[model samples]
Target chain A: MISLNLVLFISSLMFFIGVAGVLIRRNLLIILMSIELMLNAANLNLIAFARQSGTVDGQAFALLVMGFAAAEVAVGLALAVALYRRKDTVQADDINLLNG
Target chain B: MNALFTSIGHNLFLVFGLLACAGAAVMILSTSAVHSVLGFLFSMIMVAACFLCLSAEFLGMAQLLVYAGGIVVLFLFVVMLVELTKYKEKSLFTTQIKWSFPLVLIALGIFAYTMKSNLFDAATPVALSLSSGLAEGLSVSAQNAQMVSRGLFAGFLLPLEILSVILLVALVGALVLAKSERVS
Candidate 1:
C-alpha cells in the first residue's frame, strides 16, 4: 500500500500552487480558477484523513464542499461577467471600486 | 506477483498525484481564461482519482459530477460569451509574485509539518482497522458509500439542508447579477 504521506504532500503542493495563483494572478477568471484549486486541495486533505480514520464523514464533507464550490463558481463567474460587461476589462487592479 | 500487485497501488497513487499537480499548475499558469478553466477540469479529475485511491468512492464520484460537469460548463459558457479577448499575458501575472513566495512558503511549512508527522502517528495499525465505528453487530462491511450516506444524510442532515438553501440563494444571486441593466 502507498504511504499516506505522499497523498498529503500532493494535496499540500496543489494548495500552495493555488495560493500562489490567487496571490499573483490578475485575471478575474484565473483567480476564480485558483480558488477552485484551493477548495479542491482542502477536499483532498479531508478525503485522505477520512480514509485514515475509516469514517465516511470526511468524504461526505468533501462532497458538501463540492456542492458549495459549484454554487460559488457560478455566482463568481456571473459577477465577473456583469463586471466585465459594465467595465470592459476583467483586470484585478481596475476592480478597486470598493476600495476605501 | 504479490509484490507486483501491491506495487500497482502505489503507481496509481503517483499517477493521480502527478496528474493533479500538473493540471493545477497548468490551470494557474495558463494565460487564457478559457484554458485556465480547462486546466481546472483536468486537475479536478486527478483529484477524483486520488479520492478513489483513498477509498473515498462517493467523494470521487461527486467531485466528477459537481465540479467537472457543472462548474466547468458554467465557467466555459461565461468565458465564451464574455469579451475574454482583452485578457492579455502581461496582466495575467502581476508584480505580486514577490510577496506571494513568502506567504506560500510559510503556509506550506506549517501545513507540511502538521500533515507529515500527524498523519504518520495517526496511521498506527490500530487506527487503520475501523471495525468498531460503523456498527457493532451488523455483519455488513461498511463500504465507503454506505458509511458516507449514514454520516451525512443522518448525522449531518441539518447542514445538508442548509447547503441546499445556500445553493438556491447562489442560483438567485447569479440570475440577479446577470440581469440586464436598465436602459437609460
Candidate 2:
C-alpha cells in the first residue's frame, strides 16, 4: 500500500496553490474559486484523518464546511454581482470603495 | 496481475490527486471567468473521487451534489450576470507573483517537513477494510448513508440545524442583495 504521506502532500500542495491564486490573482471570481480550492483541500485532510481514526466525525464536519461554502458562495456572488453593477468591473484593485 | 490489483487504490489516488491539482492550476491560470468556473468543477469532482478512495462514500456523494451541482451553477449565473469582456483584455496574474511564489514555496516546504511522517498508522490496516468492517456491523454496508446520518443526527444535530439556519440566511441575503430597485 502507498503511504498516507502522499495524501497529505497532495492536500498541502493544493492548499498552497489555492493560497497562491488568492494572493497573486487580481480577479475576484478567480479569488473565490481559489478559496473553494482551499476549502476542498481542508475537506480532503478531514476525510483522510477520519479514515485514520475510524470515526465519522471528520466527515460530518466536512459536510458542515460544504454547507458553509455554499452559503459563502451565494453571498459572495451576490456581493460580486452588486460590485459589478456599481463599478462595471470585477477586478480586485478596482474595488477600493471600502478603503479608509 | 496480483501486484496490479493490490496497487490499484494507490494508483487511483495518484490519478485523482494529479487531476485535482491540474484543475486547480487551470482555475488559477484561466483568463476567462467561465473557464475558471469549469476548472473549479473539475477539481471538485476529483476531490470527490479522493473522498471515495478514502471510503467516505456519503461525503463523496455530498461533495459531488453540493459542489459540482449547486455551487458551480451559482458561479455560472454570476458569470452571466457580470460583464467580463473588459477583463479579457487584461492580464490574469498581477504584480504580486513576484513575491507570492517564493512565499508559497516556503509554505509548501514547511508543510512537507511537518507531515513527513506517515498518517495511515492506525490499527486499521487499510481504510477500505476498516470502513467495510464498520459497514458489515450495520444493516446497509456498501452505501454509508446510514453511518453519516448516525454521526450527523446522534452527535451533530445542533450543528446540522444551525447550518440549515445559515443556509436560510444566505438565501434571503442573496435575494435581498440581488434584488433590483424598481420605482413607479
Candidate 3:
C-alpha cells in the first residue's frame, strides 16, 4: 500500500512524456531534457520503492542517480555546444550529412 | 487519516505532478530555449518535493541542489551561449514526421511494459512501520553514519573514483571537438 496506484500512474505518465520527447523533438537541447525527464521518472520509482521497502538502499541509489545526472548534463551540454559551434544550428536533421 | 484531509493532500501531490508532467512535455515541445529551460526547472522542483514527501530527505536535498541549483542554470547558460536568436532561419520541428508516431508508440510500449513487468515483479513491498523505524534510525545516528561511510568507501569506491575520469574525458573531448577541424 505504500506504493499507491496513483503514484505509479504518475510515474508512467512522466516516463511516457519523456519517450515522446525523445522520439519527436528535433532540437538536441530538447532531447537532452527528455533524457533528464526520463531520469526523473526513474528516480521517483526509486524513492517509492525505498519507502515501501523500509530500507535506505533505494534512496542511496537515487542519490547515485543524481550524481550521474550531473555528469550526464555536463557531457550533454558540452556536446550540444560543440555541435552548435560546428553546424551553426542545433537541429537534429542537420547532422546527417554522412548518409550514403 | 480522514477522507477529506487525505483527498486534499492527494490533490496537492496531483497538482504538483501535473505541473511536472505537463512542464516536461512542454519543455521538449517548445521551440524557445528559454521556455524549455523554465519547464525543466518546474519539473525538477516538483520531483524534489515529491522525494521529500517520500521521506527520503537526503535524496531530496541532492535533487534540489544538483538539479535546480546546478544543472538547470547550466542548461540556461548553454542556451544563451549558443545565441539561438542568431539562427532565425531554422525551423522548429524536425523534418522526420514519418518517424514520430511509430517511434513514440514503440517507446511508450517499452515504457509501459517495463513499468508493469519490472516494477511489479521486483517491488519488495515491505510494510512501513515509520514510527518505529524513525525512532530507531534517529537514536543510532553516530552508528548509522559509520555504516554509511563504510558502505560508501567499500561498495561505491569504484563509481566515486571513475567519475573523475569521465569528467576528464568529457573536458578533453570538448576541447578537441572545438578545434578547427575539416567539415565534410
Candidate 4:
C-alpha cells in the first residue's frame, strides 16, 4: 500500500496548480476547469484518508462532492453561455461590470 | 517473482499521482480551450486510476464515468457552443501572474511545512477493510461497490437526499440561465 503522506502531498500540489490556473488564466472556462481540478484534488485526499482509516465514510463524502461538482459545472457553463450572449466574450477581465 | 509484482503495485500510486499532476499542468499551460479540456480529461482519468491504486474501486469507476465521461463531454459541448476563434490569437494568461505566482508559491511552502510536520501522525496506513457489522453475515471480501452503497444509504442517507435536492436546483437554475429571452 502507498503511504498516506505521499497521497496528501500530491493532492496538495494539484490543488495549488489549480489555484495558480484560476488566478493567472484569463478565460472563464479555464477558471472553471481549474475549479474542477481543485475539487478532484480534494476528492483524492478524501479517498486517501478513507483508505487510511478503513472506512467508506470518506468515499461517501467524495461521492457527494462529485455530485456537487457536476452541479457546479452545469451552472457555471450556463452562466458562461449567458455571459457570452450579453458580452460576446468569455474572458474574465471583461466581466468587470460590478467594478466600482 | 511475487516481490516484483508487489513492488510495482506499491509504485503505481506515485506513478499515477505524478501523471495526474502533469495533466493538470498541461491543462493550465494550453492556450486552446479544447486542448485544455482534453488535458483536464486526462488528469481526471489519471486521478481515477489513483483511486483504484488506493483500492477504492467503486469510487475510481465513478470518477471515470462521472468526470471523464460526463463532465468532460459537457465542457466540450460548451467549448463548441462558444465563439472561441476570435480569442484564439489573444494571450491566454492575465496580467496578475506576478502577484498570483508569489501567492501560490507561499501556499506551496505552507503545504510543504504542514506535510513535514507531525500533523498527520494519527493517519497511519491501514488496510482497506470494510466494516462487517454493517450487515448480517457481511463477508470481509464483499465487493467495494456493495460496501460503498451501505455507507451511503445507511450512514449518509440524509446528505444524499440533500444532494439530490441540490442537483435538482442546479438543473432548474441552469435551464433558467441558458434559456434565450423570447422576443416581445
Q: Across residues B46-159, which tens digit of lDDT does each residue of candidate 1 receive? A: 888988777677778888888788888888888887776755535668787888889899999999888766676555311223346554444324455666676777667888
RMSD of 2: 3.2
How high is each candidate's TM-score? 0.88, 0.90, 0.79, 0.94
Q: Give the clashing pairs for model 4.
A: none
TM-score of 1: 0.88
Q: Model 2: share of native contacts present?
A: 0.67
The candidate, 1 or 4, that scores higher on TM-score is 4
lDDT of 3 by residue, A26-82 (tens): 778888888999899888987687567665556656666777777777788888888
DockQ numbers for every candidate? 0.66, 0.64, 0.50, 0.78
Q: Model 3 segments beyond 4 Å from truth?
A: A1-4, B1-6, B86-89, B102-154, B171-184
TM-score for candidate 4, please give it: 0.94
Q: Clashes in model 3: which pairs?
A: none
Task: Provide a comma-separated list of chain B TM-scores, one per candidate.
Answer: 0.81, 0.83, 0.69, 0.89
Q: Which candidate is the best by DockQ?
A: 4
Please give, for residues B127-182, the per-residue lDDT of candidate 2 as tens digits: 32224544556754465678777667766899999999999999999989888767
Residue B134, candidate 2: alpha-carbon lDDT: 44
State which candidate, 3 or 4, has the greater TM-score.
Answer: 4
Chain A vs. native, model 4, TM-score: 0.98
